[model samples]
Target: MTITYEETRELAQRTVVDARYPNINIYTLDAIWVLYDRVLRVDPQRIDDPARDRFLLSKGHGPSAFYAVLAAKGFFPAEWLDTVADLESPLGSHPDATLVPGAEISSGSLGHGLPLGVGVALGQRATGHRDAQVYVLVGDAELDEGSNHEAIAYAGAVGLANLNVIVADNDSASHGWAGGIASRFAVNGWSTATEDMHDHDALYRAFTAPHPDRPHVTVATVRT
Candidate 1:
């Protein structure tokens, strides 16, 4: 059963209502939904397959959007949304990779996802999983972490063509990038695209655009 956008929104709202933390912002909802519904090649059933695309949610503090998308995609039961953050619930404010069916990593510690994604992309190449792609979704504010800068430079230096980064820029950064977030990646030899985060078709095109010899970064600017 294919879940429509309206259904996905309802699922997110359900989780939001059950949220115990104040950070359950649904800012990443549209981008996450678009990725799972249109772009990513990951399957809910074969999550452990080496050929599956890996999506790491680096900005994991507010994960209601993530959980909702996973549920809508059949990665887990929608009922879990009602119990989110409960003592015995698998769903928490931060997603647990082991607890969540399709999660690639246990995140929430800002700035780790991109670095881990670089390692995962390298591992895929080393293990002959050439067809797999590694994607990391991060927040603009999380980019303030030095670890991400290092990872961005390293990934670019190695020409990790199989790696893709989606930056959900809500302009929350303490020190904004001079030429915009996309320019930071572009200077590091990455193919870059900037689009409105709510523009599904534009998001699809940017995500699917080829960057043959380099990694890619799609800057999804959220409308305020």
Candidate 2:
């Protein structure tokens, strides 16, 4: 059951108790839903499979969207959406891997996702996992973190073919990149691309593009 943007948004809205922030990054959520629906590999019955695709939400501050998608995908109960951030709820502002059924990592402290994704991608290759793909979603502002640059350089150098990064570019970076985010990755040997965040078809194509012997990055631009 592929969830549409409208459906995902409605599901997410159910979890929003305060309208002030909505506790979700709507642009990133809408963009990423396409990747999960059209590109990511998964087997609810075989999550432990080494070849099963992994998705790490590096932009974790606004997790209502993540929880909504997970619930829609049957990662957990749909009812859990209403309980998010409540006292008994396992779902918090930032996803906790041990608590969230489908989350690969617990991330909120910026600049950690890409590095962790690089590690996952490298490990999968070393273990001879033929088809696993490791994906990380990051905010444009998070790129300011030096740790991400180190990971980007290392992943590109090692030719992490199984790694993919989707940077939600909302122009929130205090010190923005000169030639845009794609250029940074390109210089480091990554196969890079950019597309409007609202264009699901374009995003799908970019996200699925082949980058043999190199890591891939797709920057989805969102209006701030």
Candidate 3:
């Protein structure tokens, strides 16, 4: 089931306000609202539109946020979000692109989203929707895994500027890992910026800004 955009907004905001989803990150859910309300262009009905920008929440622990936004956007029925992640539901703990109308990637493992975004961008190019963007969200904790670096570098060097990387850096990865992520993105030739993800205005500005080159990386320093 899915929800209407207005209803989705109410449920998500209310859930966080009531503390219903304890395991779910409040800011992540907030980010979902930002995406659904302003950023992502996913159609309420035609979710698979080729020209639509695909948003992959690479940090999959934030499933609740995604579900809330999807329901709000009327992907199915708003009430069905309550059953999300349950045994009988189409929406599981991690987003499955096949089951969820707006989901573009099945995620949770963390290290694969950047590459997945790259692939999506490539496919869009092949299909002649070169103007479409493939946006991916990554977790700071997950950045400790070396696999992400390769994908990030690849997106940069390959000139996949249409693929946007939004890294939610909570600053808790190992000892020094998170500290250097933004700098690394810059050194690798990725047009990058670091901003407080909680600030809706800042987030919108950073994400919507054009990349000076191919492969843009926006490090959103969020607190949990």
**Residue 106, model 2: Cα distance from true site in angstroms:** 0.7
lDDT of 2 by residue, 1-224 (tens): 76666887888877763346765556677666886678888855666777889998998887877888888877888889887778788898778899888788998899999999988988888899847888899999999999999999998998889999999999999888888899999999999999999898999999889888899999999876
CA displacement after TM-score superposition, residue 65 of candidate 2 (Å): 1.2
Report the lDDT tens digits of candidate 3 across residue range 1-224.
44454565566554331135454454565456666678877787787688998888888865766777776777767666666666677777677778887788888787888777888889998999887877888887788777888987887787777888888777767665644678878877788878887787787887788874678877887765
Alpha carbon lDDT of each predicted model:
0.88, 0.85, 0.74
Candidate 1 collision pairs? none
Error of 3 at 31 (Å): 2.9
For model 1, give the RMSD to the true fold. 1.4
Candidate ordering by lDDT (highest first) = 1, 2, 3
lDDT minimum window of 10 residues, candidate 2: 17-26
Per-residue lDDT of 31 in model 1: 86
Instruction: Tell me each candidate's TM-score.
Output: 0.96, 0.94, 0.87
List ranges where model 1 is wrong by over 4 Å. 17-23
Residue 72 alpha-carbon offset, candidate 2, angstroms: 0.8
Mark the regions of model 3 whose C-alpha exceeds 4 Å error after superposition: 1-10, 13-22
Q: Candidate 1 on 21-128: residue-level lDDT in tens? A: 654578888889888998888988788988888899999987888898999999999998988878898888788899989999998889999999999999999999
Supply candidate 1's per-residue lDDT for 209: 90
